[model samples]
Target chain A: MLCSDSDLPAPPQEALDALCLRGARLLSGPVWAAAEVALAAPVVEAVALQGGRIEVFLRTPAAPDEALCGVLEDSADLEAALNVLWSGIDAILPEDTARTADATRRGP
Target chain B: MGDLDRLNSKLAKLKGKDDGQIRASATDSIVSALLTEIEETILPREMILTNESGNRFVLVVAGRRLLALSGHGAEEEGSEGREDAAARIIAVFRGPFRTFLDNAREISIDAARPPNRIDPTMIGCSVETLTAALVGPGQASVADPVAAACDLAVAGLRLVGGDVVGRSGDAAHLARLEQFAGVGGAGLGQLAGDDTDAPCCVFLSDAGREDAILARIAFRGAAALILAPPEARAELIALCREPIPAAG
Candidate 1:
């Protein structure tokens, strides 16, 4: 769903989930599926992890440096594997930024 | 000269030294040349990513591995049992290009693992098909072969010049392009031949002088290719994220 133009920092994961669920109720399997997958890796985190659910809280918006939020359960046994995956994610981020920025300036 | 034009020249010069159809086996030189130019010249300094949109997706990638991360829609699962999920992800993005790769005109494979080894099977369909598949269906496709060529030209032109730029058959060919708005002084040049017909070129502004001129020829459409500078790559990627219409 399109966000309002209030310049709000992306709300915490919990809040985002609420919004996503509220707008497109869970009965809609496709929308629910997309949200579930999208939440796994984030450029930023609005929600802190609690027992089983993640707590959503708005973070201070980054001005110059943007943060990505990835949602992996704190319960995973593969901390080492998760760390490596994060490293790969971090590695390509700069590339992604540059490419996206370049595309924007060139304007197709 | 505009940033785009300069890279074009470098790519052309890079390819000049390579003799094709039968060169001693080594890393695919053209792939290496393109990747190197992108890493060294186009990514050193830039904000590369922006938050223009609330969401974030990869803006660029450098590794030879075509990376993928897949799992279930809601339930977390191990890689062992997610083949279906992986297939679904690829199905959404991959298009006609799969056919092209299955039946490529050329297939170069390297059994030995070297740093720059490329699986010939990875080559997508024609450049056009690959671009469209990656960008998305219904999204307008722009063929900036000139920019792609420019990247090669910048590397090639920088490494080798003179005789290579002059010859028509295998050497190189330079061609001029019509003027456009912000792209005023810019033009395109190409280097091509029968055996290794990799098209390469440069985009140059009127104010910019060629580092080396090609000997005049019939100019049967040989545009230049060179490496794109960092800033230009960032700019180009950003433009790619425009919101797609619901229909598209």
Candidate 2:
């Protein structure tokens, strides 16, 4: 469930689980079947994998020469992957309003 | 399995105890005492204070967490002594209190500014009876002291009535931790620049668990704690006051 724009409580663990499940559905066939939880402070996101392949990529796909392909695989290995995505998004693009856009594009 | 079970157990415990098991007043006294101890023992600096709707606040350095000082005042008491009490409390923050003071600068900005919109120093929630209130009416005995302190800091932030704020680097949280840690400004800035280890720092506010969660992310560490109940905060601060060497 989406946290309301107003006040919110800690994301219920169930909600986090549901988020993971939803993320798993977005990737194509033969994708890794599980989700790993990651935290980005007030927000939490998941990283999806298929076999050994990591699915995260930058929103502004760089030209072959201009792109900065950060280490997405180990970006947030210990915690959730969405948090890592958010931080990268924030650093590359500090616009606060783009949080949802960044989160949606990079979701599992 | 143990980690999974622990997570499950913690989630299960969150099910009940929703009567807002926090005694607003009791929490206030404890936070007040902890700040008193910090002033008396740690860093003694002068304080700038203001009050609105019965809550009180003291401004510190530019980037430090706004310290909230509370006390159980005598209702039957007259105003003549209240000023003196305020003076004593202000005095508590004075004298050789360290660089937390040196970093002070007048931003000349109102408390309503964008970042200050979520005032870091304000104890956003009531602390009076947090112990009796949070641990469930029947299970106060089982309240984990560490959890309770973290609860108090979060509660303090919320009580002051601010939005839940979090970011890659929470400027105020970083500033306050630096000041509280007594690290020089340049040194503290450099430490913040070092993203090698998970950062950890305690927050004191009137907000609730949300703030604690924010602190946890802000200070990514194995044991990131946010203490709210004054007694709980005191214990955590005591631990923080320990000598973990920079070399070790």
lDDT of each: 0.27, 0.28
Per-candidate TM equals: 0.18, 0.19
Scored by lDDT, model 2 comes in at 0.28
Model 2: per-residue Cα lDDT over B57-133, one tens digit each: 34332222223332223222313354443333333332222112222221111122222343444332222232233
Error of 1 at A46 (Å): 45
Give per-residue CA lDDT, model 1, range B1-248, as digits (tens): 64334433433333233343122111122233323333343221211211122221111222322222221222232232545533332442242222222222332211112234334443212222323444444334223332333333323221122223421112222221111111211111111221222222111111111132121111113323222332342222222122112221
Q: How close is candidate 1 at the interface, in terms of C-alpha RMSD after superposing the true interface residues?
A: 24.9
Per-residue lDDT of candidate 2, residues A28-76 (tens digit): 1111111000111211222222221233322232211111122222112
Badly placed stretches (over 4 Å) of model 2 are A1-108, B1-79, B82-149, B152-199, B202-248
Weakest 10 consecutive residues, lDDT, candidate 2 chain B? B104-113
Instruction: Provide the lowest-lDDT 10-residue window in model 1 chain B.
Output: B176-185
Measured by TM-score, the strongest candidate is: 2
